[model samples]
Target: MKKFQITFKGQVYELDVEEIGSATPAPAATKTVAASTPAPTPVKSAAPKAAAPKAAPTPAGAQTVLAPMPGKIFKVNVQTGDSIKRGDVICVLEAMKMENEIMATQDGKVSEVRVKVGQLVSTGDVLVVTA
Candidate 1:
């Protein structure tokens, strides 16, 4: 058996360890002592801010493109009145440390761009409208 002292996060602890032979299993044990310093005061967090407003509903006969996942708009490749084809890269989404290309699902003229660069978006959030 051996005794050792350990300091962590400004707190001190004492430990006791016993050695066992290869054929014998060691028993688990733990001991804690009251800290000498007073406990820290709890911090109060500020209330969460309201989320950004979503874009207005799509115009009649217009097809809408939505975000595939929650992420920041890294770049916008197309704008309102721009013509697009199926599979065209519409914007770049930065999610999980990766830049994903948001593509057009069908060919059409962009009637509205609902998002801008650096805007945070969530899955199924309207991003663009086409007609």
Candidate 2:
């Protein structure tokens, strides 16, 4: 059984979950067989751990909003040198058939525009540089 805390719709709640199963009992006939078999070696997966949130900027003003995921730049709403408010729509990236609004992470002028409409972008491809 595991207890977890979850928050949604402005309300937080505690949830208790129980596994539906009975514990296995040791059988006398299988006791020797279990001891004869070597313990299975644990598999160390080559895959790395769950990545940290990439949305947060590495450092302030050196911010460059990336694709977040592999996607195409659908539309660019802001241009170079435009003074933008925080959270302004800088571009639209279409990933998995959804148009995602790429927002300005800080209040600054768009110093460089690296993408345009209908351009396919990969992860970490600089879209716009703000300073």
Candidate 3:
């Protein structure tokens, strides 16, 4: 039997594990217990604020850039009236602890910046509009 200690979310726990091999017969039953410890106090988070207002409609014939995945907007690289070309990085998205560059799909003038830094977005959510 091997003993191990692990810490998770500021809580420490002890564990016992038994290893068996194909050449060795397995025990019919086994039991293990962890050292008891007082539970940690629960944290209270503030109530969520209301959703932000929706962005204005995209201009006719404009190309809208959409979020590729659910993440927080790490940075916005372009603003309204900025000229951009195909493959230009429009913004940076932080998802799963990785930074992803959101690029423009078509060339045009940025008509609107629909999201801001630190704002959470979902897949298919509009990020920018270009015309």
Candidate 4:
């Protein structure tokens, strides 16, 4: 199971998500594991420490936007150095079979494009850096 901590209305909640194999079993290995570990066990780990902002100048010269979740790149709507406005569809990401529109959080020029079409990206991996 995966746990998510969400803050809402000044309150925090912990959600437990039970992950079943893909809606359909693609192979027989799924049956074997199910038979061995009758019940799914959840793993727990220590909380991650928060990162402090850098006081020195960033060599990149802009804020970087990353993939909010891991997924395959479906399409790109802008190119390097292209100016984008708030809420523009920057790219399409296919995660968990859903198409997520990655939007620009701020108005800026695209400084970098880090992934190619059809490429897979991980959560928090830099997708674009804007100047």
List RMSD in Å for every model shown.
9.4, 11.2, 9.9, 15.2
Report every candidate's CA lDDT. Answer: 0.87, 0.77, 0.87, 0.80
TM-score of each: 0.60, 0.52, 0.59, 0.54
Instruction: Residues 1-131, candidate 1: write the lDDT tens digits.
Output: 56776665555567977776757665555656578867767444445556867668778999998999999999999988999999999999999999999999999999999889999999999989999
lDDT of 2 by residue, 1-131 (tens): 56677665545567967656649633334234476799877443344446654533334646677778889889899887899888899999999999999998889888778888988888877898888
lDDT of 4 by residue, 1-131 (tens): 56687765555679977668779634332234655576766444446555765334434568877899999999999899899998998899999999999999999999778777899988987777788
Relative to the unseen true structure, what is the Cα RMSD of model 4? 15.2
- Residue 60, model 4, lDDT: 54
TM-score, prediction 4: 0.54
Using TM-score as the yardstick, the better of models 2 and 4 is: 4
After the best TM-score superposition of candidate 1, give how far the Cα of residue 102 lies from its true spot, in angstroms.
0.7
lDDT of 4 at 49: 55
Off by over 4 Å in 1: 1-54
lDDT of 3 by residue, 1-131 (tens): 67777665555667877776767755556655556855667444445566888878776788899999999999999989999999999999999999999999988999889999999999999999889
Query: What is the TM-score of candidate 1?
Result: 0.60
